[model samples]
Target chain A: MTRAEAFSEREVAMCTVARMVENGRTYWAAGGGTPLYSILLGKKLYAPEAQYVTEDGVIAPEPMLPYEPMMTMLAARASYRALAWGTMNTAGIYSQLGYMDYGVLNTLQVDRHGNINSTFLGEWGAGGRRMHGPGGADTIAACCWRTILITDQSKRKFIEKVDFISSPGYLDGSEGARERAGLPRNTGPWRVVTPWAMYDYQDRRLRLMARVPWVTVDEILAECEYKPLLAPEIQVLEPPTEEEVQLLRTELDVRGQTTDAAGGWIVWDGEKYIRGGGD
Target chain B: MTTVSEPATIEVLASGTAPYHKIDPDGFREWVRDNKQRALVPKLMTEKEAVQKFVADGDYITYECNYLTRGPNSLLHEIMRQQKKNLWIAGKFTYVDVGMLVGAGCAGKVDTGFFLCTPSVRQALDAGKLEVYEYSNVIMTMRLEAGAQGIPFIPVRSFGGTDGFNHSGAKLITDPYTGQPTVIIPALNPDVAIIHVQQADKFGNARIFGTGISDVPAALASRKVIVSAEEIIDTEEIRSNPGLTKIPYWCVDAVVEAPFAGYPGTVPGYYASDPAVVMEVFASVLRGAVEPYLEKWVFGVNSHQEMLEKNVGVAKLLDMRKRETIRGGLRA
Candidate 1:
């Protein structure tokens, strides 16, 4: 549990997300990659009582060890000892029934209002690069009580406004806008986990609440295209505990696809951690 | 820090101008009643025969579940191999299946919720060779349910604030009970529904081991169901566990015993997905060698069995089966 351990950006992001999973709460970490690692690691280390579900309707799936990296959310090889096996109907109906407490989503681009887009880059019809349409993020964002967004932090990603609202956030950043748009009241974006920091919605606007140990407030702000509202006291997150790092490396991400030191979003550049890696 | 602009309207206009692929519920119901077979006869056939007989040109078709799970890859390959023209596809949470279909020029229009926009699909879209309609996964699944129930539309609570709502056939309707705005998706009765299952009786009493992701509803909603299974079990075996039968014989029109039907995909207790094979196919697609890849795998082979023997050897398939043995003991 020592803090004097070198951690990659993925470890920081995964741990931050893991810490948010409350015990006994039900969560659906929508996509694979880091979001998958976060919930699985969270269940193992932090919230053992927390129930994790897949979009394919497997509830509380005890994922197999030595994780399979290639497979996404419907990873049969990774899932075993599932409490209940349902279908896409179960996933959607449960969420509508308010059973899904937390929904972690992966986004390609996010805005200051927490509106995220994983659909397209530019204007959707005018020759925008189509980055696969939303699978369940729209449903999760629209139905789940609380939503946590995860993505890498960069000027290109953290935009002033998303090209398309693939999922609902604080629509138009106005109070009661989500209700007006027919989304359930009190169910919207809750927190955002990124490589450099974590954010929460303040008055329906993205407000930076915490930063990783290595990064400064200026550095995070510099990386964002939009100026997000800063928390009154932006706490610096402690470096991941040695055990947390070990669990991620040896158990969840056995292939080093995500939590690897030399691969993924941030890397050790001899003297300091820097961005730009991963295949 | 730059000053933020004034908050914009919550309304999002659809970017694409493609017309929605709408089907008249009454017309579809009458057609299903007039065309579908109600006899309790064995509708056994090969993939080629099933696709040719049931799937026609310009028909709206969808498959059960998705490509990663119990995807009907053999049927899709057969559709491509036959070059079914002007076909419309309904893709819900699909990946390479839609891409391959579009790339092969079999399908021209897609009603999709989550389609992987491959370079080939993108090229087609840019070239005006393809049309895509957007919806959420839940809405699409619910549409199938609506279709199965012979309903015109079903009201839902989501997809209002997003851009997908603007592009889809779904409409924001006033809830009669609460007077609140609600999203209602139309019924989707596909012309043909191709499904792959672990086991099925000769009369198309199918049993899927894993999650039945919209298969039953899709089968019931479609005019025809082409079922491919790992094993053709006896009716007595199906009668032993009547509860496990997801798609009943009445909805199914053809039964094709095709093992490894969901190749490069998993079939729960049968075999684990072959990621290397999927990666290789995707890589070939990215390199613009879709034609060569298809020719080597789908078009070149005589049947799914021959394709398996030629492309994936028995040793590799057995290894996948061994990897999937973990689920055998766990399933009840």
Candidate 2:
């Protein structure tokens, strides 16, 4: 027993995913869709290569326009494939999934006048001038994985569900039922990354999609008060692509997304630890 | 670190209730004389040399459990690692692929590399260094289990309906009623299901408790079964504690015990893995990368004992880790 060994091939293998990507990375974008944002941002984070698949199943890195939607929320109604958040390049390149409070913000907001806001990755005060819109370190980081949020005419307020988004991070409690359950009511496509895993809002329920490392698909399922018709994979998760890793790392570098960064804006816990365990 | 006159015999308990029994390798050689079970094709294999010889390159090897402690320098890891398309995973354990993904920057095919297991495991994938290929066999298994349990397509709204749901491999079927598509996970029937158990008897009933995966299905779905247990008690005791029994005796073809079976593993009750040693390896990775660390930790080892002899046990590592925690960081 005195000479026994610690650490097995199996155990080490489990923790390596979190360790693969070192810190110090950043993602820059005007917002296209969630998957694309994730793919590009993931590259900065994990430093891994990527495999880009076309809508037709042809794997490629160069899909040009539709994936870069003018609006935030979108959905591929037919394949059931969605691009509610981040940079998505699927089917016909629709808006992220979103549902609005008033009538429906289904009408894409055309800001082609180019008044779009620009988010920064450095200190809150490091920006050149005064803040124009709602965005900070992670707010921008969220953009790496988040694409659109259907908002009411009110600038500060936003809706929860997109007619469609890429990842289901938030819900559309824009209406009254939310207060009954103590849920945060929103007016636009709101977003959140629960400790457990990735979430996307659809019709009504929050679908538990991909999970972070160390998190169980069930753990997320249990926490999600609302059950969607679908759930994420039961397994922990497949590893990120090489490019995705690189993207996260690069973004972390520029913005400093780590335990030591952002005044610990995002707290690390048992749930979040699942994604970046041993970090 | 000593070599025996013959490879030591091991025992396997079925479920938790079944009593232990001895598995005679010699008798096993004789029992398999006719090779009647050979017709099924050897799926689950032991670390034994004979079993390794039988495994072919293209076989779909499904053994959910990764003998953490045993795998670093394990011949099976070596064998499985060589194959670009060997399906050596299950619904139980899949943390094994993290290192390769990080080191290689590519998680091989889903079936080839460590696929899906738990949500925590999924986190590592999303973080990167764990995902190489993109196939939804994971959703396949969950749905398959439900299907095997006699349910229509189980509901799963994950992978974000993005490309994941759109993935041809991820989608199992299209829903006719809702006019919405339903993801279908085709039943996974692996060609082989290999597991390292605590013990086994001549008849074949076996069991263990770490993470309950679809061993029953893995065995039943596969054509052949290979049982490697740590100990094998008499058949009568097995009948006494039938509650723990997982596999029936008739299904197994070979029985052998390889104690410390899940070596290099942090087996809850059976073994301990040195956290410091892992930290030691990772310290190197922190200083540089995983390749040198793997080269030394993985390739430097000549045998399991030699590897053990080179480091301390997990308890000591835990103590060191605790002390280091108090110290804040490890000082060179």
Candidate 3:
């Protein structure tokens, strides 16, 4: 199959998420996988001046160090501004300093109200599946002007309500819910980007905004546990363009960190797009 | 003012709801008010003395370090060798330090952002021998910041929706001015905080390079701060580079000069991490041979110098240092 034909669900999700990010906005990204790839793709394609800060507060702009040992080593390099703990203690403080404009987070579950869950699934401790703790999701969700959630499309994940709210979205779908919940008036999840479709909050309720070219509104609704409000202008999401695919291959996925269903890393080695390893 | 009831014994809950771990806020307030008048002077000491003098059994201790950088390994080794028991440890993100402590049975409870999935920690948690409390890395820092600022609690926006919010010691309070619900995390105020840095003066004004992580706030939040430095420079050097200083001398109780302190973990401007050794140690931990690994590497060697010479060897150390030169650019 051709490279474009072989575009994986993850790549599509990442590209779609990347397109939503505005250029030159400060972004705080949490969890690896698709969210990290999306931020890197956004920086490479459009958000060149985007200030990217890791959860631990390592701010590095574009022409950034290569991933892997370099990202770890360069994290401690003097050039990376380590905003001392006091200034960047909470996500709210970081947002107040104009550091966090947008956030891309990988949540285990996202509810209709946009509340995210990444902490625990069933019971607390041994009985439950203990996921990674909310690193800065809570803080960022509380203050970032806009937040984007990237997760796989599944009935189990798109639930009526999250098992636990790890990060507040719009609580109870009320007008002043976020303000009442102590979150900044302007801050909340703006987009819920999944492989099958995209969602947004309107009137503090989950609304289907768009769907992948292959999927329909019926399919999207069938996958959600709660009945979702349909957007007035629901559109079909554009597929990954050639340039987007190329950037994802060469710059972002050079290490072949993420893979497709066939267990291959989609790579572009100057001449053409190839699957599996990079040049 | 809400009065927190003092429990007969400190109960460390694995998870569930607010006040997961409790301390009498009134008692803490009285203690802080009394101790605030005490003057602090930096005492130059050995890692052994610093660990022993400040860290007590069942004390809540925080290591001001990140996942794989400036981990205060020397102090951790000393604590391991001494085998201080029932200690509650906290940090932003812990890998080796937490792993070793849990493996050695020194850590009774952990309140941390992130911890490595080591067999020892897993086995302990599964066996119900270890109590674990979770927080996001930034929230951990916020707790420390509140402690440093001498505040009862700080209002935060995050964790309102997570299981951590339900299980945390943080309280949900309405903002009087805005009538908005905000989560308020209580001050941590660890009994002792151990930090490793790039350089420090004899008086303990220390500077760290690379990502400061939560080190500054951790140091400031502790009752006693012990700093281990790769180099002990003159106070004049610290004065010259004032902007780089993360922990001032007033916050420091003791300073120990220990070169190559964060071995295996990199110290930014000084050395690159020895990934091979780190991987080997982790492998050994996963294989349930942590005792042998700790014996040969931690206790069997008398000093960090001996550990470097006998365990890591000069050639491997030299090679790791050489790799840093190529990777040492501000921008790639």
Q: Specify the highest-DockQ model's number.
A: 1
Question: What TM-score do all the candidates reach, one by one?
Answer: 0.93, 0.42, 0.82
lDDT of model 3, residue A154 = 77
Maximum-lDDT candidate: 1
Model 1: per-residue Cα lDDT over A1-279, one tens digit each: 665346677778888888877899999877566777899888898889999777778888777776443565455655577877777778888988899998899888889888878787888778888777788788888889999998877888899999888888987988887776667788999998887889998889999999975678998899899899988999987657778888888888777777663224544556665555542
CA lDDT for candidate 3: 0.70
lDDT of 3 by residue, B243-316 (tens): 77778887788899987788877766667678767777767766667888788878897777778887887787
Give every collision pair in model 1. Answer: none
User: Which has the better DockQ: candidate 1, or candidate 3?
Assistant: 1
Error of model 3, residue B207, in angstroms? 1.2
For each of the candidates, give the backbone clash count.
0, 160, 7
For residues A72-111, could you state the per-residue lDDT of candidate 2 as single tens digits? 1111211112122111122111111111111101111111
Stretches of candidate 1 exceeding 4 Å from the true structure: A67-69, A72-75, A259-279, B1-18, B328-332
Model 2, C-alpha of B47: deviation from truth (Å) = 1.3
lDDT of each prediction vs. the true structure? 0.80, 0.33, 0.70
TM-score of chain A of each: 0.91, 0.30, 0.81
- In terms of docking quality, model 1 is medium
Report lDDT (Cα) of residue B58, candidate 1.
Answer: 92
